[model samples]
Each structure stands twice: as C-alpha cells, then as structure tokens.
Target: MTDDDRGTRRGEIGPTERLAMNRTGSFDWDLDTGTIDVDEAGLLVFGMGAGAFDGRPATLVQALAPEDRADLDAVIRHAIITGQTSYTAHFRVDMEDGTPQWTHVQARILRKPDGMAHRIVGIVRDTTAEVTHSDFVLELERRREVQTSIVERTTHALSRAVTVDDVTAALTGPGGLARLGADGLALGLVENGSLNLIALSGESLEILDDFRSRRLDRGLPLAEAVLSGRPRFVPAFPALGRDFPELAPYVARMRFRAACYLPLVAQARSLGGMALFYRGRTAFSADERNLALGLAAIVAQSLQRALLFDEERALATGLQETMLPRRIPEITGGEIAVRYHAAWSGRQVGGDWYDVIPLPRGRVGIVVGDVQGHDTHAAAIMGQLRIALRAYAGEGHAPSTVLARASRFLAELDTNRFATCTYAQVDLSGGTVRAVRAGHLDPLIRHTDGRVGRPKLRGGLPLGLATVFGEEEFPETRLDLVPGETLVLHTDGLVEQPGADIEAGLAALADAVRTGPPQAEALADHLSERLWERWGAEDDVALLVLRRSPDPGTPRAPRIHQYIHQADPQGLSDARAAVGQALRDWDMDDLADDAELLTGELLVNVLLHTEGGAVLTLEVLPEPVRRVRLSVQDRSSAWPRRRTPGEAATSGRGLLLLDALSSRWGVEPRGEGKAVWCEIGPVPTPAGAPST
Candidate 1:
C-alpha cells in the first residue's frame, strides 16, 4: 500500500486508533498485504533490515518468541472460538540477532457470516526496559514484606515482658534471637566513651564486657556507623584483618564472617548500637538493614522509659521522708505512740500528719489532721498548720480556743489552703479530756472494759473559712476518762479510701481493734493492715494512740444508794438517816448530817405533788468528783421555771435548797418523765474529802 492509502485509513479511524498507529516505533510488523512498515525508531529497536518486502500476510504468531509461541497461539485461538473482537498479551519476541526482547501484542479478529475468522489485524510493541523495571519493583516489595514480618514478631514478643530482665531475656534468648537470622548479637549501650555490654544473644557476658570495655574508636566500623546515623555492614573481615588484629579472636569466636551494625536512635539522639553477626560471608539486603534499625529504635525507647520511671520513684520517696515529722515528743502521765504510713507503690505523697504539744497545767494537746490534696503543696500546707496549732496550744489556750486561733492563722496565712483537724487536750491532773473537731474523723475512746465510745462534740468548718468572715464555732466537749482507757486519733486516710464506703472502712477499723491485740503498737499495725487490705493503700495514713495511766485515787465498784421519801417532815428526817447509813456502810464515818438535810428538802417537793415519791441516786464515779444526782418527778404537765427570790413565796424554797446544796443543776424532759437533777460536789472532810 502507498503512504497516501495508509494516511487515508488512519484518518478515517478514531483518536485512539490514530494514536495507536503513531506509537508503533518500538515494534516491527507487516501492514495490510504483507509489506514491512518500519519507522526509524522501530528499525533502531529491532536492529533489522528495512526494505519493502513481498511475502504472504504475516499471522500474529509470526512476531512471538519461540518460547512464547504456544501461549500466543492459545490467546488467538480463544479469541476466534469465542468470537471475541480482540486479544492482548505480553510475550517475548526473538530479534534478528537471535536475542529476545519483550513485546506487548494486541490482535483483532475479523469474521465472516459463516462464523470463521479469515483475517487477524494486530499491533506489537517492544517493552524490554519497562518489563525489567517492573520486575525489579515487585522483587523489592516482596523483600519488604519479609522485613516487616521479622520486626512485628520481635516487637510482639518483647511487649509481653513485665520486667527489665524479662525484656533482655526475650531479646537474647535462643528462639527469639535466632528467628531474626543473626548467628550472634550484641547489645551495647553508650557509657564512659565506650560501649557497655547490656545484653548478648550468643556470647558470654564476660567476653562481651571485655570487648566493650576497650576504647571504641570513632572510626571503627560499628562506631562510625552509629556516629554517621546509618547502618554499615562488613561483608568480609579480611579487609580490616591487618588494621584491627584484636577483632580476629572475637570474629572467630562469634562465627561471624559478616556483620551489620545499626545505630539505636530515638528522638534525634543516638543511644547505642546493635551488632548482628552472620556466620557466612553474606551481605544484608536493604530490607534486612531496615529491620535492624527498627528493632534498635524500639529498644532505645523502652530503656529510656524504664530509667525515667525509676528516677520518678526516687524523687517521690525523698519528698516523703522530708515531709513527715521525724519524731514525736514523750507526754507526761500518758503514753503516746504514733505511726505514719505512706501509700504503697505509688508516686503520690499525701498530706496526713499528726502532732503532740505539751500545754500548761500538766495537760497535753494532741492533733491529727489532713490537708485537701496529695502532692508537695498539700504536705507543705499541713506542716504549716501543724506548727501553728502547736504554737497556739502552747500559749495556755483551751483545746477549742486553740483550734479557733489556728483556723484564723491558716486563713490569714500566705496560702489559702484548708485542712480537717481534730484537736484534743488531756488534763492529767483532772482526769478529763477536752476536744474540738474541725470536719475530721471522730477519735475513738476504748475503755479498759473493752467498750468503745465516741465523744459527743459538734464539728466546725475546716480552716480557711475565716476568709469570708465565717465564724468557726469550736464546741468544747469534755470526757472523764477512766484509768487504762485508750484514745485513738487518726486522719481519714487511715480508714477512708477509694472503692470502699467510708462507713464500711470505719467499721473495719473498729473490728480490727476489737479482735486484734491491745497494745498501742499492735493496734495501730492491725488497723493499718486492715485498711490497706480493703482499700489497696491509695493514700497516706497517720495514727496516734494514747493510753491513759492508772490513777491511784480511783475507786473500783463504789456503792450506790437510792432514797424515796414522802412530803411530810418525818420523811425528810428519814431521808437524812438513809444518806448517813449509806456513807457509813461504805466505810465513811466522817459524814456530816447537814449535807443530807439539803438533799431531803429537794426530794420532799417532788413527793408532795407527784403520785410516786421522789428518787435520789448517789454513786462514786472515777477521779475528781463523787456524783450525787437528785431526780424529782411530778405528774403535773408543767415544766420547771426559774423564779426570782423577791417575786415567789415559801414554795420557791425548793429551788433555793438545790442551789445551796449542789454544785450544778439542770432540768431535762424525758418522754413524759421530767427530771430535775442536782449534782452535789464532794464534801470537805478530814481525810481529803473521803478521797472523792
């Protein structure tokens, strides 16, 4: 065909058909009637003769290489049998020089109405360079998969470790290290200008340490690779055999003919290097080098995290030691024991503290308090408050008064912090304890008889309330403690904790004391253990136990006397005789009858109005006072009212009799049982008022 005919045929086709004809430079083929159509680029690619040739029409199989002829035939046959319009394939074609070149063939079959293909029109393009480039990319991708698998397996095994030793064992143990295809491996950490042997896979620690202790020159293969921020592999040691003879023994012992050293870099900092040894003289592929670097990075990060944790624990422990009080003072007439326990195995240093201050008049002030946070600031605030409270108590103030002053001091101090505190003063001489509570746990009093009692006291607001001019009313409460009674004061951290109800914790503490040993040390230890067991030790705890000393003057099982009398004067005389006989029966012959006359007058008033006679009960309690209470009940639905002496007639003489004979008196209503009580002080006798 002429060039004009070819141009006309190409113009009649679509844009895709026109471009397909123009891109035929990489192939040689016959067009139309078996005439060779060879462009200049196509002639250069095939290196074949370029002349018009007269021959039969060339079939699609004519361009296929000898080895790919069968595949090309199969594709053509399928297209013809299925009446497919076209078939395409990638195959190699034999060139004129007997060399093979890759080619892509696309064949179009033309069929008649008889279902038989008579003509096959196709295009062939050489793709030798493209196919070679594509095969290289596929090979690299497969190698990447192998490298990723190795890194994933190693990291998964290492993450299961709970301790540093476990991590090292997992990284260096036989199965774990061999899986990475290293004949022997050494982990070196940068220390003192030389690599310190942290771990090794197939070498003794002594050998590794000795080798690492030698000065690692910066230009050494492993050291240079780390410093240059790239991996280096020594394919053979023969090149450096003469320069570094000392490495010959290590190389032979480790069976390493080839070695790859990778730097452990994390966050732009070089930690050390990991040396992977190979038994054969084999070089690492790019994928193997990447895997080595990735594993080294993971090791560096994990080691850094462990070191940081240890440093944090050291700091927390040091802060706790400085925060807690070093010693507590020895109290006179009382045995004081204190125990402070910080929470176990955590970084929090809580703000629980206790203090004991000696006050004037043979009294000791005790305090247990907790600030509102769990850090250094909380602890510092606790110390400041403790010092301020002690200073106030030392100034001869009552327990309630001391707390009020301390609250004001905290409110006006530099810090606007608040604290819950329990302040108590034990009067050794009087056998009484006065206390004030400021939003704190109530201290428990364990009697010598094994009975526990919580003293009645109204709790005030915590410190720092005075900033708003909010007055903190500290209710002063007094309790007469018997000899051998024990008092326990503690912060809420001792009994209150996370995941535990406060009431349950309190009950647990009480049960521990009830069932455990009785000594102060034993009791504190048992209660602390019970608390930690239930609550898991989430906060700091402080405890103080005070055991009251036995008093020599206290009576044991003193006698009690009751007298009932009518309203008549004869009954009053009879009441006087009952009092004298009771005192004498208790071995007290020094009793005077004048004190009994005052008691009889108060009882006669109740008998005159009520259907039942009056009841007068007297008992000797512990130290300082012998109590005598007179209860007068009447059926009248009227309450007692105090009256002026000038306004009332002779009927007011009953109250005057109570006021004259009793040290204190009060009236209280008890569910239709109204009682007017009169307490008489111990009378002065020759033998120190019968020892009260």
Candidate 2:
C-alpha cells in the first residue's frame, strides 16, 4: 500500500469513536477495591474534566447532586444485595456551566465464586432530551386523569338530584370539595337579575359572605362571568386582589394561589356561576381552564333539571290539594282527626285520599281509599270518584249501596285504574257504625279501654275490578260502638312495610294503638310517628280516627271493652289479662281467675267457630248486686249449644271450658249477632275497700 492510502486508513473512525460520538460512555468499577476507571466519553457525560476525575467512584459521583448521588449509590447496593446481573438508573448531574444535565446509566455486575460482586462494567449516556419528553407526557396524562375523574364523579352524583336543595347539598356536603378537586369552591344562583350565593365550600370560605348578593357587574368576577356567559381565570393571587379588592380578605383567609370563575349557562341563558380556587397552582393552563368550563356545563344541566322538577311538583301538589274536601264537617256526637302523607319519590303526589261528609239525621259518612297508581292521572281519577261517592252517601244510601255505586262509578270512567276503599255510615247518637269494605283493609275498633281489635268484614273486589268481574256486591258489617270508642279507617300505606309480611305490620299497628293515648288526634299521631315514619314513608298514607263522645257513666257502673281478632295469637291472652285487671279494680280480686277463664272460653268459642272477631265487655253492676258481668259478642247468630265430646277430642272443648268456669252462662240475641254472658263477682270485697 502507498503512504497516502495507509494514512487515510489510520485516520478512519473505529467503533469506540462511533460510540463516543453518540454520547455513550463506559466505566470499569473494581467493587472490591472501591476504585473505578472511566473513559473520556463517560467523563464528558458526567460533566467532569480529566483533571477533576482521579479514576475513583467519588470523582464521578461528585459531579452529581447530593440527592442523585445518593440515589445512584442505593441502586448499585440494591442490585448487588438482590443478586441481580445488571443495573439501570437515571439521574441529573451538575455541569460546570451551572445547568443540570440528565444522564442514563447501565451496568453489568460480575460476581466471584462466593456470589459477592467483584466488578461492574457499565455505560453512561446523556439522556436530557428523552427524559424531558417523557416527563411532559406523564404530566399530561396525570392532568387528563384528574379532569376525567372530576367530570365522571360530578356527573354521577348530580344524576340523582331531584330538587334544587338536593343539588346544593351534594355540592356542599362532606367530601364534596375533595371529590371536586378544588381547594375551595363557591356557588351562586341568578335570582331577579342578581347573583345570590347559596354555597361556599372550604374551611374558612364563609368569610366571603359580604358579596353573597351582588349585581352582574364586572367588579365581581363570578357575576361578570354569569353576565357574559364566559369564564375568567386568575393564575395568581396578585391578579385576583388587583381585579376585585372586595375579595382580598377572603382570598387571604382562603390561602389560595389561583382561581377560576365559570358561568353556568344552559340554552343561551346563565342559571348560575361557580368559582374554584387552588392552593398549589400558580398558573392556569389552557387544559385546566377548559376543564373548569366543562364542569360548569355539567352543573348547569343538573340545575336546569332540578328547577323543572320543582316547578312540576308544585303544580301537582296544588292540584292534589284542590281536589280534596275543602273542610271536614263537624258531626254532632263525635270528634274526628285525619292525617295524610305523600311519598318521597319524584313528585310526592299519589292517589291516596280521605274524606268526611255529613249525612241525614246526625249521621256522618267517612271514607279512606287509594286509587291504583302514583301519577297525576290516578290522582285525577281519585278526585272524581271521591266526589261521586260523597254524593251517594249524602243521599242517604246504605253503606253497602254507597260503595257498590262508587265501584260502578269508577269503572265507568273507562280508565285502566282500580280503587280500594272502606266506607262507613256512623250514627253517633246511637253509637252504631255500619261499614262496608271494597277490597280494602277492615276497620279497627279501639275499645274504651286500651285494647285494640280488627273485625273481619267480607269485601268485594276493588272498585273497577269489581265491575269488570261482573260482581258489585259489598257485604255490610254492623258494629255497635260504645261511647268513647275509637274507630280507625286507614289506607294500606299506614301498615305496609317493605320485605315484610302484612300480618307483622298489622300486629305492630295494633300494639302501638293499644299502648297509645285514647284521644283521637293523639292516637292518629302516634300511629303515624311509630309506623309510617319508621317505614320511611315510601308510599302515600291516609288515616282517619273518629272518637265517639265519652259517656261518663255512674262511677259504680264503670265498664271495660276489648275486641279479640281471630288471627291474632295474642288475642286470647290479652283478653284474659284485661278481664282480670277489671275484676281487681272493682274490688272483686277473689274472682279474678274465674273471670279470666270464662272470658277466654267465650272468646275462643266465637273466634274458633266464627269467620270474624268478637268483642268482650266487662261491667260492674250498679248498686247492691256487687257482681261483675262479662259479655262476649260476635257477628255470628248461631247460638253455641252443649256438646258432648270424647276425652281425646280437641273439638267442642271451648263450650265445655265455658261451662266449667262460668258461674252462669247464657246466649242472647244482639243486633245481627249473638252475645254470651257470664257473672263472676259477688265476692267478699277488698278488706278496707268501700262497697258501692
């Protein structure tokens, strides 16, 4: 080869020069000796001069910041301890020119026979551009996630807001600010061309109350946004204070660095405005401002929906009240109390209703009913049916005729709706209640005493259903209410509970009634508080309590009454306990057992053989007899006779129990019923008690 060709070959670049030109460097670290050897490229990557490095690990480490140096040491130690074959790390080195240069490192760990690291061969490269790009991408992703979370959670929460108050509570309640990703929040509504602040969320943001009600002037950023339907962002507190001096005090107390005000615009009009303040951020990026605007749009939609719901609900409630009776008439011989509750779902309007109408000759007709559904149509049908039913009863029709005609009336409307009702014609002068049931719950009678009973009245199908089924016969049940007795008529909502048997609800109602005050208004209130409120008032309820005027009889002739339901397990025991207590009070304690036993026997006979229930009355005979008389009355007219049964027979033992326990027992005819009577006392009076 010629001299020129050989010179050109020697000047050609090798692989080592190529790697150095790519900013890649190499190092040989003798781990055992704690010494390192670095190439020129590595020294350049570390921002160290040849004179500054002395072939030791500290020489290169000195070029790194203290935190980066510690981090690199930790990476090496962790790799050796975990028996790794290689290690990788990224860090920043301080350069001679006082600028930070990002560097990436890769090393190969070589171990001895005992598995201790002997040497590390590694490479270093300047990674400034790559790391900067990666960091930018990561930050963008973080912002996107935060903005997405704010929109998603806020939308889900506002979806269930049914009223304006609900929307307000959702935004200001616990965890609201944190979920909204704001250090502080302010909300205001547009009312009468002015902004009325309704919500302020933060630890000390209530200090902003001075500008709570302000005009749409540019002096306040939020008001200005609402006026123009635009958003304003203040990236620093200085700008905030300079723009609105009134907000300076609150901004100081809020300890916020940045803020954004957004207008809540829906369909070309502003409904409200919202303000978000940040303690950590000093500048608002375009992405951040756009996120605030999107949140404001979501809030605007929720507010619009809630306003519409409130408007429609008010209209429906007004319609419901207008259809009901203007005022309940005062009956001559009784005091009446009524209660009504609307459900909490949607609009709070339903088909439940109650009415009281005055009839001929001191008779009052009371009705409690429920149309089929909960919408406005059902309520409309209920109004028409109530008026028609009242007309029939006021015309002096029988209770049965009133309900039957009402059924036909409902069916003639030709709507796909049915109604269940219990109607009663109460003759207060004679203390008589004639009631008819149309696929509704039976009426309950609370005795002069504390015991409560339900009478089994036969019922036809529901109103429209009865007519559709070609049968409209509603049987009447005749019940004689003694003076001071309370008759209760209520819709099913009063005693209905979710996921539970209807029987359990009825038992609870009876217990609440039995232990409650005897006054009509007080009893109705008690039932409402105990049952309806406890059940969440998920359905509409209508309740009526009518208390016959008290007849304070002669003191010596005081009396007690109780009704025993056939389906009640506690009925027999309750009746027994009541009778025994009465006998003790009348100074006839010696006959308590016999009186209790006879009372149970007669009640059992009526309950077992009859389809309905029975009423037990215990009276102290006035004057010289000094005897307690007990009578058990039921709707069945078949007189109970003597029955001979074998020892093993369980049947016909009720009459035998009565025969064995009573002093003298006889059956007498009552109003469409039969009464069994027995006497218990004439006992030696209590030692020091006066005999009447």
Candidate 3:
C-alpha cells in the first residue's frame, strides 16, 4: 500500500481500536471452522486468494516456507486441540514474485457461545528488516557498555594515583592498555621539543630509546595526532613505510601494526601524550576514541594534584625544621639530654619546646612550654616565649619571679597569644629545685628509692588572661633530690590523647621510671619511647630529664638568729641578749659586735614609731648560712619606703643605717604587728684553714 493510503486508513480507525490492532493485529474469524475472515495485509504478505476457505482444513502451513512448515503446523495443531489462547512462530513466506521473506506469525483460537470451534484469527508481518536492525542496535549497545566500563575503570585508576609517576605507571600498566586490546603502550612527556619516555608497558627501555631517537617532528603522525587535541588511530604502520621508514623495521620486530595516540591535556595545558599499540591493523571506532580521550583527561588531572601535594609536603618540612631549636645548650656538672619529636603525619606542626637556661648563682633553669595551637603561628609563638623565658631567667630571678616576668611579657605581647609553661631552677650543689607552674602539667619527680611525687604548688593562670595577675600565683615548690633521683618535665601532648584517660598516661610514665635507668640519656630515651607507644602523640612532644649526682660532702646546718626591737630599755637589752644567745648557740661569738649594731638600728625604729609597748623576736635556724634575722614588730602596718638623698626624713635614717650594716633586710606583715627583719653574714675565717 501507498504510504498516504496507510496513513489515511490509520486515521479512520478509532483511537482505542487502532491502538489494539497495532499492538496485536486482531481480525474477525469464521465460527465452527478454522479460517481467517479478514486480514488487511494477509493477501499481500502470503500471496493467497482473498476469500474465506471455511471447513477446508485451512492452516498457516500453506503460506510458510517448506523449511518452517513443520514447526508452524505443530504450533497450530496444539492450539486447536487444547483450546489454547494463542501460538507464535517465526517462518519464511513465499511471496507472489517467488521471493522468500522471513515473517513472524501469531494465531489465536476463538470460540463461539455454543462451544463450537471458531477459526484461528492471526496476524503476520515481514520481520527481515526489523530483525536485522535489532541485531545492529544490540551490537552497538554492547560496544557502548564496554566503552563505559573501560572509562569507569580508567577514571578510578587515575583518581587513586597521587603523582606524575603514578599517573604514567597506571596509564601504561597491564590493565590500562590491555583493557583496550592493546599489546604495548608508551607514555611520553613533552620536553625541549622532544617526547621523553616517561613510562612504557610491554616494551624494553632500549626499544623505547630507539623509537624516540627518530626525532619525529611535532606535525608527524604521533606528535601531530596528540597535538591536535584529539584522539588519532593509525590503522597500519606498514602503510606508513614511506612516511616513517625508520619505524618500519622496529614495527616489524615488535609485531605492531596499529596505534592510537591520545593527548593528555588539562586546563588548556598540553602536558604529554599516551600511545596504545596493537598487533593487527585495527582502528578504534569513534566510541573507543572518545573513551580513551576521557581517560587521558582524568590521568592529567591526577598528575597535577600529585605534583601540588608533593610541593606542599616539602614546604611543610622546611617550615617545621626552621621552627624547632637548632641546638641544645651544654650544661656543666650534670648532663642535659633533650628530645623533641614532631608529628610524622598530618598537616600540623607541633609547638612543644624545651629550654635549659644557665642562671646566676650556679643554678640552671629548666623550662618546658606548649603553645595552645599546632600550626605556624603556634610555632612562632613558642620561639618568642622560649627566648623571653631564657632572658628573664638570666637576670638572677627566682623561679617564681622569672615566671611572673614571663607572664607579663607574654600577656603584653602584641600578638596577644597564650602558652602553658613550667619553670624550675636546679641548684647543682644542694640538689635543691625551685619551680613555678603556669597552667602546665605537673612534672613528676622520681626518687632514687622508687618513690614518685608531684610537688604541691598552686598553678598560676595561663598568660593572656586580663585578670591573671590576681587569680594566679607563681608559688615556688622546692624539691630535694638525692643521688640517682630524676625529674621529668614534659608537655601535655605526651600524656593526653583521644579515647584515653590522662591518668593512664601518668601511670604509664610512672611505670616507665620504675624500670630504672639512672643515666639522663637512658631515662630520656625510655620516656620518649614509652610516650610514643602509649599516647600515639598527635602534637610534638618535648622531654627534659635532670638527674642529681651523689653529694660528696656531709650535710652541715648553720645557725640563723633574728632579734626585733622594742620601745623600752629592757627591750634593747633583751635584743642584745637574744643576739648573744644566737652566736653562742652557733659557736660564732666573734661576730657579736656586728650583730649588736644591726639589732640597735632595728630596735630604734620600733622605739621611734611606738608610743607604748612593742615586741622583739629572734629566730635561729641551721641552714648552711648562719643567718641572724631581727624583726622589730610594731602595731603600725605602714612599710618603710625608700628615700632619695635630697628627700629628708628623720625616721627613714634608721632604714639607711640598717641597710648599711646588715647583709639583708626587709619588712613583712606579722599577725597584729609588722616585723622589720635583718640578717647578718657569717664571720670571715682567718687565713682560710677550713671554712666553718
């Protein structure tokens, strides 16, 4: 039928009936006989006369080709005997021109109300073109699925890669080119007008060198193919014998006949190219080319990311080295070993640091501090605080005084940063340590006999708080160490970790000390190993170990005496008698005159200030230095202020005389009274026979 006649017939049919006929191609049939009553296209398709052949044993076998007649006859017989709804078969039909055409036929058995057998009404259509088209579409779909899988796998491989070498290796690896049915592959990087062999698969280095030595121009098959920013397929290398004679011999040896060159371009930068080689003269289809180019783009991006990450790692390494202390100081008499461990992984650099400062009066100050954050800023702040702590300790200040000055300096610092630190001064001769804590973890002191103690001291507020001065006290804690005793100072980063209690870390440290390594280096190594084992330290860890040596001489205690002044004459006599008693007790009677003069000035101050009763007190103690402290107690709470030479005050003259005669003097508030104290130095030995 004409196309317009078919369209008009389709339009005349009702929408629902037309849709049903189009789907099933149903038609009327004769009841009580197996015969088709009407089939619009049956005469043209079957080359049969257009008349009903009722009760004549009509069957589809008449229209079917001889080779399919048996199968169609069997299907129709089964449907007729069992009253089955339908039967289907594929058959070839002999048309009017004696041409055989493949057709798909479906028949249904219909029944009348009286249960009489009805004709088999069916539809048949020529299926040769449809079947061929279906097969072609399926083949296309299979190729599409293969290409999609290849692209997905290649993209995944590229994403996993983290460096240029990684990208090159992945691109040229067994799975990469082999997935595309390639026998060999080569990856090149563009450099100095030549393609350098960055990577290769299934090829020797010598072969690659020989291939690259041809010095092919940029517009040649390989370079031009990639430089065009498109994938190019070389069907056969033998066909290019005239154009590339040098490659012909090698191509024969390698048994490579075809190749595909894919460019690696990203962000408008042409980095390099990849070549896939095959054994036969096979050219990739359009889909294969697109897949290869897509994979190349992924490889390029992965390589760039890897290079950037490498650069960042190098920069971080340099920054970390510069932030840490270059060298530790050399201390005399005692060995000082310090260990600083930086975090090996992650983006942060530690701010933990330690310093061993030499203080005046033969004492060494030990400091361990941690800035709050872990970054470049924290490292910079640590450096500033370390230098400031050393400078403050060098000024002959006690541990508390040094911490106080450091706190003030850090608080007033323009950066307005904060840090936690512990400062201690060790007197090598006496094994006496004076320490101050500023919101820092308490250091552990392990005695020689396996006793561990954290000294009792009030922790000062951290620096940078506005009200820190009032809330925090740099209380000094003194520790007396015997031979083989060790003091461990560390930052919290060593002990504090996620998912673990801090007490566990402390217990671990204590157990480590109990294992017993007496040397400073040995002890430091032990502690460092143990800390690393348990805490898996996140921040940098800094440790300082100080051990005391055995004392060579016996301990000796000197006598200290103090006498305060009173208003009465009896008070003056009482002060003199107390001074005499102190010297006699310590067997230092030769300095009686010096003690008497010091007492006179102190007593006169009480007499001048008090109108009534005043008190005088004396204290004697054995503490190496024979200290004579005199306290003249009065009800007045006022302290004596220093007076300049021109500023005249008759009462302040006693302080001047007291300052001149005594070794040390100061005023401190006593219960209900203020005490002015003075101490006298020991008497000089005659000719230095053995200093008493």
**Among these predicted structures, which one has the highest lDDT?**
2
Pairs that clash in candidate 3? 560-620, 561-628, 561-629, 562-618, 562-629, 563-630, 564-631
RMSD of 3: 16.9
Candidate 2 lDDT over 1-692, as tens digits, reads: 86556655999666677778988899999988888999999889998777878888887778788888899899989999999999999999878899888999999999999998899999999998888899999999998999899889888888988788888887888777776788889999999878999889876677888888888677888988888887888888656767788766566676788888899988887798999888899888888888888888989999998888878778777777787887888877689999887776657578888999998888899999999998889899999999999999989999888888898999899999999999988888656687888889887888776668787776789998998998889887767677788888988888887897888888888888888888888988998899897653778889999999886644455577677888998989998998888777766677788888787778888888899888888776644666777888987879987878898987777767766766667776553477788876565544554666
Question: Candidate 1, which segments miss by more than 4 Å at Cα?
Answer: 1-314, 414-416, 551-692
* lDDT of every model, 2 decimals: 0.66, 0.83, 0.67
- Candidate 1 accuracy as TM-score: 0.47
Q: What is the C-alpha RMSD of each candidate to the true structure, in Å?
A: 14.6, 7.1, 16.9
Over 4 Å off, model 3: 1-84, 89-103, 110-128, 145-263, 270-281, 328-377, 390-403, 421-459, 466-692
lDDT of 1: 0.66
Ranking by TM-score: 2, 3, 1
Per-model TM-score on C-alpha atoms = 0.47, 0.74, 0.49
Q: Compose the digit string of candidate 3's lDDT tens values, residues 540-560.
A: 788888887643322233323
